[model samples]
Structure formats: C-alpha cells, structure tokens
Target: VSDSGLGFSHNRFIALIVSIAFLVVLFEGASELGGGMIKAQVEQTTSKFHPEKNAEDRLKPAMVLATEANIDNSVEETSEAVAAEWSAEGSCQQVIEGNDMLQFNLKEMVVSANCKEVTVTLKHTGAMPANVMGHNWVLTNNTDFMPVAQAGGAAGIENNYVPVGDQRVLAATTIIGGGQETSVTFSIDSLVVGDDYTFFCSFPGHYAIMKGAFKVI
Candidate 1:
C-alpha cells in the first residue's frame, strides 16, 4: 500500500509540469499573433495620413501645378504680343481747318503711327462767336463718335461743349469761334492701326455735318 501511494504522487507531479508547459506555449503564440495584428493596424493608419504613399495621389498635385503654370504663361505672352503690336510706330504731324459754314476743310485726315507727337491746329475762319457757331476738334473710335457727340452737347458751351472726364474722347481741342484758333497735341502711341477712328466738331449741332474719318497709317 505505501509503494502504490508514492507512485501515484510522482505521476501527478509529472502531469502538472506538462500541463504548465503547454499553457506557456499557447500564451506565447497568442502574444505573437496580437503583436502582428497591431503592427498591421499601425501601418494602415499611417498610410491614410500620407497621400504620397499612393502613386496616383503623389502625381495628381504635380500635374495640377504644371497645368496652372502653363495657363498663366500663355496669358502673359498673349498680353505682351498685343501691347507690342499696338505701339509699333516711330513719329509724325498734321493740321486741320474749320470755317463758319460748319465744315472742316478735309473730309479725311491721315496720321502716321510712327509719329512720336502729333499737333493738330484748328483755324476757325468763321465770323460767329463760340456760342453761335462753336467748333471743337474731337477724336474717338467711329462707333463712339455719335454717342460722345451727343453727350458733349449736353455738357454745354461753358465746358467747351466737350464731356468732362470722358475717356471715350481720345483727343480734343477747346471750342473756338470765327477768326480764332485752337490746337491739341497727342502721342502717336495712343493710336491703333486698322481701328476706325473719327474726328468731329462736338459743338451741339455741328457734329452732324462737321465730322470726317481719321486714319492711322
């Protein structure tokens, strides 16, 4: 009876050690699996914040930047070309005469784009005063002539029958009467070739019969 009891205790001891060893190995395996999962989750979260990690995302910004830069360059080049074309002349000069019959001596006035400064002298050979037969030389685009002329009339004779601070009036001379004269000097660079320009007397009722074409050569 004593020997059998000792053998039973020894077996129980060996069984307990084996069970403990198995439990240790299982815990270790589970720890390793959890660590791998955590590492994978951290990598995925980092990738979400860093767009450069994806090939398409990385290229998108660069392409957009290049396209915008190209468009700006194109606009700048076009604006420069237009400015150059508009100012391509050297220097020139002209004269015009107005009379009491509400007429300018010339039906068509020619100007040179190369003229650095153009001086237009208006000699009014009429016998009436400015209030009766006022004459002023005004220049503008053909399309704006009539409208500007009408506006000038409303401005009244006190303001030289010319609209005040009007940009549409490219150039103008002060109103003058018979035996009197007026002149206007302007830069040639203000003119554009091929543009239809007209010169007229902005003296109330005179524009209807006292206007003519202005040409730039």
Candidate 2:
C-alpha cells in the first residue's frame, strides 16, 4: 500500500533558507567590491598630473630658499630639535631691534625644523647708526654661540659682524642700522629637531646680552 505524503522536511526547509541567505551575502560583497574598484579607477583617471610637479621644479640647487616653502607640519612643530641636527636644519626668522643701548627686543627665539626654509628679519628701531649700534641676528647651538660671537667681533663692520664660513654659525642676517631692516632665509634640513638652539647677535660683546633660547615646537 503506497502512502501519499505532503509533508515538508524541516531540515530541507532550513537548508534552503540558509542557501538563499548565503547567496545574498555573497552577491552583496561582490557588488561592494566592484563599486570600490570603479571609484578607484575613476579617481586615478581624473588625477593624471603628477602630484609633485612643483616640488620637483623647486628642487634645483639655486632654489634661493624661500620663507614660504613646503616644510611639513611635523618639522615645524619640532624646530628646537633641529638645532643640534647640523644635518637637517630648519629655517628661522627673528626681528632684533638695536639702539645705542645695545639691546634686542627679544631675549630668546623659537625655531621650527618643520619649515623647509626659515627667515629672520632684523630691524633697527633706534636712532643709532650701524657703525655705532648695528645689530644682526645669528643662530647656533648653545655651546658654539659664545665662541662664534667672540670671533665675530674681530670680523669687523665690513663682514656685517659675521665671521666668514664659520661652521658653527647656523644662520645670520645682515647688520642693520637704526630705522633699517634685513632678513635671512635658509633651509631646515641642515639641522635636527628636539635639540638645544641659541639665537644671538654676534656684535663683539653682544652675545651675552643679545641671546635667547631657540625652540622647535
């Protein structure tokens, strides 16, 4: 006797549901992957030009070291460390005011190594002439500052109170007289970050009186 049955196996029904769920998941994943690939290809097609074109052009030896160059933010935040670097130096800018009293407006300066180039401006706000009370901005490691300043005294007025080719000298500005101004811009790649730095005036006996702590951050 053959028995007529119209019963659905519960296991088979559960398996069918699972298979459908798996298929749905697989298709969704593939679609997402395809969409991501398409977006990436579109972006690549749109950005055909080289990203570093300007940077490559400015990399010549005679770049003149502008103050507004592309020094990354990480370097600027860590300027003081560059003072001891001697190899990866940063650019700095300072304005020093000189009068007959032989003083600077600032006692110290902070430098950032994150700058591709640094610029320091020296302004003489007093009535004294360059021959009488000239002031110039100078930078170096704390240890080398005093010696370099002492030697710069003998360099005389013609040398702008700066010694020629001094290895210890990191950066220097031209001497400025009262109501005059000067500025210097240099690269930061010559110094390291997180090291002690000093900025001063090398005008004979000025280092002791015209100096300040240089910071990177």
Candidate 3:
C-alpha cells in the first residue's frame, strides 16, 4: 500500500510539473502576443496621426511591456516566498499546505529524532469552508493509519475526525478551512526512528489522497 501511494504521489508530482510548464509556456506566449498587438496598434495610431515620422520613431510601446514584465517578476517572487514558507521540513517544525483539491502539498515529511518535540502546521490555501473541504494533520503508525482514519470518520467533524481519546492517534490538528491554519505539537519520545509512520487527513473521503509518509531520522 505504501509503495502504491508513493507511486501515485510521484506520478501526480510529474503531472503537476508538466501542467505548470505548459501553463508557463501559454502565459509567456500570451504576454508576448498581447504586447505585440498593443505595440502594433500604438504604432498604427501614431503613423496615422503623424505620417511624416518613421515606424521606428512611433514605436514607443516598449515601456508598457517592460512594466508588465517587472510586475510578472514581482508576482513570481511573491509566489516563491509563499511556497517556501509552507514547504519547510527537515527539522523539529514541519509545515504543510492543503487546498480544496483534496491534496497535500507534500507526500513525505521528515524530522530529526533528536528533537524532544515536533510541531506540524497545516495551512488551507483554498477558498472553501471547513465543512466542505476541511483538512487536518494526523499522525499514526503505518499499521494504525487506515484503522484510525476509518474510526475517525465515524467520530464526526466535532472531533476533528479523530477517534476521541484513542491511543493510536499520535498527534492531530483541528480541522480547518480555506484561509485558515492550525497546528499540533507532539513529543518525539513516543516516536521511533526508522519505523514506518504515516500522516493523513481524517476528513471523510479525503484520507485516500491527503495522506503522506512520515519519517524520523
């Protein structure tokens, strides 16, 4: 099952990369096309009003394109900063993001076993309410993951879809909606290094896609 999940994650990652690349190509082409169209229109207007001047002399639309390019760069940088903030791992603190798409931004999380306590932050980046597209971070042994998740479903959203007072729940965060964030901290003393662990969402029908491997080293 773990292997299958890994395979699915890997394939999804590849698909996402490909889709992003395609989008980038389309966006660049559209930007260029738009700039060219605007420049041509400006040049035509200039030539029509002042035919004595050459086409090169009337082409003054480059400034607008330059400004647009600058704006694009700024937006790209801001996006990278947000992604960096959420992708943090490899320490005592881990950050993860989920959206209305029923997906987690990461397929694996790792922490150092030396840390006394570990913190996990879950950020919902979509535009949905908690009842519709709620997400939470749940940690359990690999063997207990599915069973706990199943029981959690019966426990309802009031319990963050986690089985109440269940020892199998190593850690879990409260369910959150779009634009909301929640976190949970658990002691690392109960965690064993090199053991099979898994993290998932306890939301009904979401565990299948919103799950990942958890590792301690």
Candidate 4:
C-alpha cells in the first residue's frame, strides 16, 4: 500500500527545510569569501598611496605606519615570517653590531616568545668617535619610525640623538663610539606579535641605512 498522504507531506517539508538551510550556508560562505577578497584589495591599494609618509597629509589620527621615499621601510605583512631572523630561544638578550659604514649586522631581530623582558645591546664596531660615527639602538613601531628618527636628529648629540621622554620610543640605547656597548632593557608585554616594528640608530642620518625589522615571535 502507498504511504499515507500526511507522511509524504511531512517528508517533503523536512526536505524543503534541509534544502533551504543548505542554500543559506552556501550563500554565507560565498559572502565571507568575497568580503575577504575585497578587504585584501583595499589594503593593498591603500599601501601604495603611503598616506602615513607625511604628517600633514593625514586625514585621520591613527597609528602612523608607512614608508617614505628613499627609505627601505617596506615590511612584510603579519602572516609572512622574516626570511632571516636572529633569535636565541632561551635568552632574552640580543646584540646588534653597527659599523662606520652605516649598516647593521642583522637585517632582522627576533624576540623569542618566552621573553617577558628583552635586552638589546648595540655595539659600535668602528674606530670613529661618538660625535662622528656614533650609533644607538632606537625602537619604534614601523610608521612612527621616520618621524621619531627625525626628532631624534633634532634632539642632538647631548641627548644621544633620541627624543627625551618621547612616548613613541619603545626603547632606546645610549649613543656609543667604537668598542663601546650600550643596551636597553624593555618589557615586551605591550608589543604585539607579528606586528611591524623598526630598530635603528637615531644618530643624524644613520637611521636611513641602519634600520632593520624588529620581530616578536
């Protein structure tokens, strides 16, 4: 005998509900995918504009980040790991070498995840004096780097070319001459993992070539 009409109708209703739910899921997934693609495109386009390059062109106040012309400030996004990183898993202390040629030995410094506090030591390896070939390690978020570096130059030699009491400076080392070493100990609690950070010598004109990425992994 054929099934009851009521039973058939009930099965149809269940099937209809299932089909509708499936459609809804498919639509939601497509929307999410499309939104992600749009977001990536927007950000990519925005970076080319470099609105953060100049202080005056800013339309809104935000954490300033972007590279200006003549500066090698292009940083990889948060998802990409540094091609070369220096890190000691058990030690929170790292040393950076600066020579008279206006370059750092390492292109990227990585802080291990276990570090609650990090110590960065800047060692001057040249024979020049502080007044001529001084070097210091200054740390700041990527966008704030150039501005802070400019201010540091204006601050002059007496202040080690670092802005005094500047909140934008996450940490700074004292200026040192050849064979001299200075270090800055800072807590990594406020730093975000994978975010862009810069470390450079704030001495006049040194940041232009002595800068490198500071990564927290």
Models 1 onward score TM values of 0.57, 0.55, 0.60, 0.60
Candidate 3 contains a number of clashing pairs equal to 0
Best by lDDT: 3
Q: Over all chains combined, what TM-score does candidate 3 have?
A: 0.60
Off by over 4 Å in 4: 1-88
Pairing residues by index, what is the TM-score of model 1? 0.57
lDDT of each: 0.82, 0.73, 0.87, 0.83
Clashes of 2: 30
Per-residue lDDT for 1-217 in model 4, tens only? 4554666666677888899999999999999999999999998878757756654556434423333321334334211333444345644888878988787776778887679899988888898999999999999999999999999999999999999999999999999998898899999888998899999999999899899889888
The runs of at least 3 residues in candidate 3 whose Cα sits more than 4 Å from the true structure, single-residue gaps closed, are: 1-90
lDDT of 2 by residue, 1-217 (tens): 2323535466766778899999999999999999999998987876555576455565654464542353333235444443444342333444445566676655546565667777788888888787877889888888998888888889997998888999899989888778998888877676777778888888777778777777665
Against the true structure, candidate 3 has what lDDT?
0.87
Q: Kindly report which residue pairs in candidate 1 clash with one another.
A: 90-114, 91-114, 91-115, 91-116, 92-115
Answer with 2 or 4, whichever has the higher lDDT. Answer: 4
